[model samples]
Target: MKRISVLAAMACLAACDKSGFNYDNIIDDGGSLQYSLLDSLQVQMRTVQLDSIRTSGTGTGLVGSYADPLFGKFTSSSSFRLGLPSETDPGLKAIYDSVELVLQPDGHYYGDTLPLQRFQVYQLSRPLVLPKDYDAFYSHQQFPVNDQPLADVTQRIRPTSGNKVHLRMNQQFGLELFEKIRSKSDDIKNEEYWRDYFKGLTIRGVDNSAAFRLLMNDTAVVMRIHYHIVKETVEEKTIDFHMNLSELQFNSYSYDRSGTPIAGLTPGADGIMGETTGNRTFIQPLTGAVTRIDFPSIAALKELGRYGRIMQAELVIKPDNGTIKNYPVPPRLTLTLADKKNVVTQGDTISNAAGVQYGNLVTDKLYPENNQYSWDLTEYCRAMMAADEYNYRGLLLAAPFSEFHTQLNRLVVGDGGSKQYRAQLKIYYLLYE
Candidate 1:
């Protein structure tokens, strides 16, 4: 046994002295131990289209449209119901001045905002309602609106300036609303009556506009009806109608991929392979698109030795150069386990011993080659190897749930076989002889 141990140690040192091998620590417990590094494992990647994502009650509303050469066209619209003011009566003698819709930016946006963007507000034909079977609205849900717009405004949006956008509504619509409040009519007296009369409003952007998010808090978005009384030198008063049920507010997202690489991609389907699309995979959370990674040859690692353990595993994801120039990638990404059907396994998020892992991202603007996101997959590999059967399971790379439903962040990464930037998985295994 002593002579065998010495010979094994010599062989381990000889292997480590190779050009691409580094000497890692060793473990000796009456067994011959050797460390080997493998980075040539097969990694398969594809773009998966999620069925639908909940978009209601996210505390943020999206609006506007933008076209991308790689991602095609994306459009978002916000819809919400309005509530009557607490002070139901504006007084019988009050005269109507004007009404305007105020939208407060939450400092989140995608695409360009330098040029003027056009926004239109239309009253929903029916009230916003969630079906009995559904708990919340999804990004694909949309309600019908009137033919004519209640408000149309075009202006340059300043997302970072901490300013409010005041869109003056149609004169007739404002006048009718003001008249009902002044008279204390039933339509303006209670929530039910008000919601029926004024179902809600959907704010949308015209074509070729940049997408932006608006604050959906209690005081961020509202419609102020200006009025005044003829007594005591014309005292001015404003009655604000805020969003009635903020929980019901939702943003509807639509996309057009007719001329894009993923035009034929179908939701809940087998997904498009990376090699078929120029060795690239896509992830755009707003549209429920995620990147799927599979390791078909992972089992081959077990053939290296009779008894082995994975000491460390690392996954590095590299986005294609020049894809993030104007369109920024998601700030953080999560990896979740999904079956072959692309259904995510609940509570199966990938993590290390510490906690859930968000890829520790490193950006390199000057040296774009260094831009990458990496994660420790030591435990995940161990579990995958210990499974009873080859479950046809894979990892779905996506943005966090909070940002996934509310933001338009996206990323495009290269597969393992890419020429410029490729996703890589490196594993350090300890072999016992």
Candidate 2:
């Protein structure tokens, strides 16, 4: 937020205006704010901080927020009505505002040059369960359709009753779904050319139930649907794992591939990394609002079982917008020094510098075809936060959050000037015993 003295400094800096207050001939967009010699004087400006953070809980964690300011000034009896709905919590507040002097010569049309008030408002709701009162919430509700502008190819899902275990997969991701069926035998084992299978491919009825079943071919081969999303919402659902295969072992892991656009894994590293090795992992979150936001959030996931033995799983969904309110995050985010040297001169270039370094800092997407993002090394980016003064270990995961976006803030500004500046935010979580 700009302080009072800063506002004065701004006015003085622009005092270089000739016709009126040209202050270096201000022109951010295509046009400029100028003055003529025959107009009176006036100024309007404001600065504000959101009052308090709003919070809600789910399982054992919470999420919260920041502030947004509102201000304006006009010559007449101004009457501007605001339309912000305060459905929940204390009404919003106007942090600061003021109107003042522009005394100057006549014929010199003049006006104020104050940075407008702007902030992101948020409401953290109680963290919800996967199948809790789901029916009551979305029973009659219909999701507003914004059809996929581009449809992805459907993976050819083959199901052979015996031979291997198969799992169904989401079509948006174009990876081949492999079913590990009965390994090998004497008779027709030589025909293992992409183990052929049968699948009931109809787009109606108890979709998954009719499809995600175990089947075997005469040659003793099996197929499985890796995973499936049957119900849009459920009051009670379970993920039945083949207790025999699972070792009943659940591991904590973080998304560390070079392609994800998370907060802490850019050209450096942060807390989310699992020991620079593959074993350490972080649990993916699934919350109600977030479930409704992302395609594969926890609430939207359902793992079918053998004899209906549901595997235990928990999910927390977060808002798609990049902020760490209810989620445990540092009061403020301070990024590690970006390499700056590996800057890209073009987008499609696949040179050594183009692979990982440039992807995280310059683009939200890395593996665009698969909708994969880039990650920022949270600890390195926020090395300053680890000091004794900050003390953010278990309380905060200390990783960066990412979102898929098309407009690259880099291209819009280039070397000419910076246009819109945004940061890779933090994603926090705690996997309990």
Candidate 3:
């Protein structure tokens, strides 16, 4: 009896639908007025092409969920091929220099109806010195002791039997070395001679007198300065894959010191390196569109010098009024560094092996609520360090199914004609001596 009643009810409903509504009319309207699938319902949509974008800050912004602070979280698929004379063959180097993603609109535009709504830039100020090792910074600066044995009075010039001489910066600059040195002084620029002499000797000094020094292998120092291309600003022949969106527009944004409008920069395959060590936190002051507060993770804070805590982030956006008709937001993409340990030690030659460990990262403002990272970062860092392989995977950072660099590739999807959003991507940098 229940089954018969249920069948009768279904029939009645079906009959009522046919009698009261016309499915044909709805289709004619080009909208699902009466009924349709999700895809068919959005007909008034304006399309921004899949080919229009490439890049986000997180290596995973291409597929992850993030509201990019900078429009950098998004960029057009513009191709750039730079000319580098230093490279002999330029195979990998050539490829690195020839990749970029161009952003395209459904229609070409000009003048009052510019296809792109917002174009901005950001400038970050960083300190010149780097902090790579522990005990690197001090209240009073000091130099390293020379690692090589001193000149050999006996075959090998070993400094004074057991006493190894530590060369400080002041020692070479002192009156003793500068006043008495007689070699190569005739008709030579005295300043040039002095500078060369200091470079040759591992002179040591202690602080005003404060010029400190540490004696290290010149070969090691030279090795540290090597410049291998890390990230190339690029536009590739093809993209990995892409998604389609009806429309996108920019609303309000956190404006910091986005540098001069990004227009000043030529988009090309320029291998840029990470400006600082990976994931250090600092407070960045803002002017125009850049906004915020910052407190970087302990590991990142330590890795980046104090200046890094206050850093600049660029959000490249083409802002539009709330309801612009067809402006498109470029898709955010990312290139993640394969994480490993102890592989990269030089500015040049960024190997996939040298990417920083995922476990070592800690961002204070990764989430939108603007929550703070642990204040006692040393303790928090220690706790993170204590995790074993078994428990650490998901607890510290999110776990991945197959790929290791989920952080780099994650990006936010736009919806409800949302105006403000972001996708982030990273570039590595090097300081060559």
How do these models rank on TM-score, best leading?
Answer: 1, 2, 3
Give the TM-scores of the predictions, in the order they appear. 0.89, 0.16, 0.15
Q: Give one digit per residue, the lDDT tens place, for model 1 in 1-433.
A: 1222323433644454323322244447575665666677778999989987888998899999999888889999999988778776776788888999999999999888999999999999998888679899998889999999999999999998999989989989999988877677888667788888999999999984589899986689899988888976989999898886888999998999988888988887589999999999999977978899988777655433334456788999998876888877666888877777888774332664323468856998799877888888887776666454545457889887667888788889999888788898888776554
lDDT for every model? Answer: 0.81, 0.18, 0.20
Estimate the TM-score for candidate 2.
0.16
Error of 2 at 235 (Å): 46
Please write out the lDDT profile of model 3 over residues 30-116, one tens digit for every residue.
432221111111101111111111111111111001112322222211101111112122233322211111122212211122121
For 224-257, candidate 2 gives per-residue lDDT tens digits of: 1223223564222111211111111111111122
**Each candidate's clash count:** 0, 76, 89
Where model 1 places Cα greater than 4 Å from the true spot, the runs are 1-32, 347-349, 352-356, 388-392
The positional error of residue 144 in candidate 1, measured at the CA in angstroms, is 1.4
